[model samples]
Target: MKRVEGRVALVTGAAQGIGLAVAQRLKEEGAIVVMSDLNAAALQEAARRLDADAIVQDVASEQGWIDTMRSIREAHGALHILVNNAGIEGDPSAPKDPQGAPLTDWNKIFTVNSAGVFLACKHAITLMSESGGGSIVNVSSIASLVPTPFLTAYGAAKASVQHLTQSVALHCATSGYRIRCNSVHPGQARTPMLEALFERMARQAGASVEQFTAAFVAQIPMGSLQEPEDVANLVLFLASDEARYITGQAIACDGGYVLAH
Candidate 1:
């Protein structure tokens, strides 16, 4: 039997990159996938290509979470898997350190990255408990594990996600909801977001993008950047029955980058 056949799964930020990869993997595993993204145009096209459902959603809005849950309840009546992959890295051009980054950037990053995951977990747990429980895989970052002097706000927000994920997991486990929540920490993924960050950082350092990328890869013990599908594979495992015993943990899919870093 397919791992998640007949299961209803929702992936946020599914327009591209890791989100898109996770959506595709779930669909391939026989899940009934619902893809959501703030970018309506890209989401529609991606959903069309995957023959999946799409919801244009802003993850940072409380009303958006309410509407999203309502839509899921109406459409599927059950949500077996939720991938909270929506997040922002803040303005790359701005200073990102604690001493230099603006309060506005910090607020915006936390609103979306931290608070967004919290809201998603809040609403999802309710429906999931009502619909027979589910799994939540929050896409955090390696930034949460280590210091991020150049991306302070983003790191702090992701650390919030990590903590909240554990709290939610424990809450459901104790409440007999059967819901599992965990966070996945990815490192230096080769996504459009990372590419943009690399370009900006390279320019800031007056170095070629290739040189910057090479320096990054050199830090990774595996000597390469991870692809979106790499992280998606781990998510698939967690979302499936195979990881039924696993909960309240933060796993990294960084090709050993976290280890060396």
Candidate 2:
């Protein structure tokens, strides 16, 4: 049988980037996927690409989780996997401290990145328990493990996600629920978000984008940056029966960036 044959999965932020890659990987492993994002047009486009059901939702809202679960129940009857991948990098506002970051920026990052994962897990666990258990993969970041200078809020939020995953996993295990929870930490991948950051860094350093990218890559012991699929492959493994024994762990797909740096 296929790795995830007959399974149903819900992936948040599935319109693009890491989420999109995870959804595709899950589908390839034989799971029926349902994806959601705040970007309606992008979600629709991603849906078309995967031929999967897609919903537009603001993941930061409590009602959005309720509605998303309701839709999944009505459409698929039961869900076997939940991938909490929705997050924001916060607004480009000034820092509040000597570094110049703003409080509003921190709030925005926490709301979507940390609180959103909490809400999704809150609802998903309820449903998963009823169905006799499921697997959850919370997409965190390498920032959670290492110190990130400018993106303090983002790092903190992802760190919360890692802790939350462990908390949920321990709860389920102790409470006799079969559900499993884990977090995946990805490093700088070649997504639009990374591109934007690279552009900024390139301009700041008076270098071309390629030059800045090479400089960044030089820090990784692996001598390269990771691709979205690099993270997706790990997610796919976690969602599969092969990972039935794994839970409450934070796996990093950073191409040695954490260690090298």
Candidate 3:
């Protein structure tokens, strides 16, 4: 109920999926939200629909964060929330050469997933510290905690994000800043990315998408997949004053999927 009222939030990759859900949730809770994404058209449309500010950007670029922070300062006066949610699925389930991936693939994965998060946190801390501190939530994945075949690069990148959150939190604490940093790991959420992944798996296994989904769901003790809103709810809490004392932790909104195996 308006827990984030009067706050200013910037959500990267806000064109769709979990990022879009988080932006909407923050706005609904009364925060002035700025949505950014690489897809300019989609970002514009989403911003129009949600009535939030939009910035088309490649989060991996250093200048992207600079321009974004400048815009935020001009429009919102200060930053209160930064949700680093931009990422890519990286390589396909079966690559051309599974045993030996190209260095390009590895670099691209780390560039967007890990480097983007670092850039956001770096600039966010500067603005947040000036404004009496803020909150930062880095969206990680359950793959970071467990073994993930064919997604080695993605898993490694997310693992770095988890540790990055802890380091940022500790630095802020030691510096006497009120800012908080944490990571959220979601497993098998029903987003477009997951849908495409399921479809790919279905084709590879010679099964229908529904069948593949059902089989996957069976592995989760909760017997269900999470929705983007479910993760967004937790993000809202962490962005709000309710989670003021919480920082430097990796929390899972995985519907018990991570524990099933």
Candidate 4:
């Protein structure tokens, strides 16, 4: 049998990028994937391609989470995997440093990047426990593990996600729940979000995106941008039975970017 055969998985931010890749990977491993995203059009297209279920969701809202969980329970009866991949990088035009970043921007970033994960974990844990256990894979960022002086809000928010994952893992483990929670830190992946950032920075520097991308890749030890599939592969492992013994860990799939930096 395929890994995770017959399991039900919910992958957020499934419209594109890493989220889409993860959903695809899970389906390939024999999972019944339910994808969710704020972009209904893109999500529906992706879902139709995979022939998987899709839901419109805004991870930052409490009501959204409740409705989503209710829908999942009603449709699937149980959720075996919850991948919290929805997040934002904050406004590139806004001051990214702590001293200059607007409070509104900071709050906005936290609401989606960190608080969203927290809310997802909170709801997923209760349902997973009732369903006899499950796995949660939170998408963090390598910026959280290092000093992200240029993107303070994004880095800090992802750091909170990492910390929250650990807390949820320990709580479930000690409570005798079979649930597992872990965070995946990706470094310099070529995603829509990252590409947008690069474009903005490139314009500011009067240079092409390729020039900016190459300069950025030079900083990574692997000398290449991490592909969404690379991170999705690691997420697939974490969401599978093979990682039953692993929980509350922050695993980096950064192409050695974290080590060299």
Quick one: best lDDT, which candidate? Answer: 1
In candidate 2, stretches whose alpha carbon ends up further than 4 angstroms from where it belongs are 96-98
Q: Write the number of the candidate with greater lDDT, choosing between 1 and 4.
A: 1
lDDT of each: 0.94, 0.89, 0.91, 0.92
**Number of clashing residue pairs, candidate 1:** 0
Model 4: ten consecutive residues of lowest lDDT: 89-98
For candidate 1, the per-residue lDDT at 129 reads 89
Q: How close is every model to the real structure, measured as TM-score?
A: 0.99, 0.96, 0.96, 0.98
Native-vs-model 3 lDDT? 0.91
Q: Candidate 3 versus the native: TM-score?
A: 0.96
Model 3: residues with Cα > 4 Å off, grouped in runs:
93-98
Model 2: per-residue lDDT, tens digit, 1-261? 578877889999999999999999888888999999999999999999999999899989999899999999999888889999998887744542327677788888899999999999898888888877889999999989988876788898999999999999999989887899999999997788888778876887799999999988889888887889999999988988789999999999998888865
Clashing pairs in 1: none
Error of 2 at 52 (Å): 0.3
Candidate 4, residues 91-171, lDDT tens digits: the string is 777988879999999999999999999999888887888888989999999989999877899999999999999999999
Q: Estimate the overall C-alpha local distance difference test score of candidate 4.
A: 0.92
lDDT by residue (1-261, candidate 3, tens digit) is 689999899999999999999999999999999999999999999999999999999999999899989999999889999999999977664352346666678788899999999999987898998888989999999989887765777888899999999999999989987899999999988898899888887888899999999999998888899999999999999999999999999999987887865
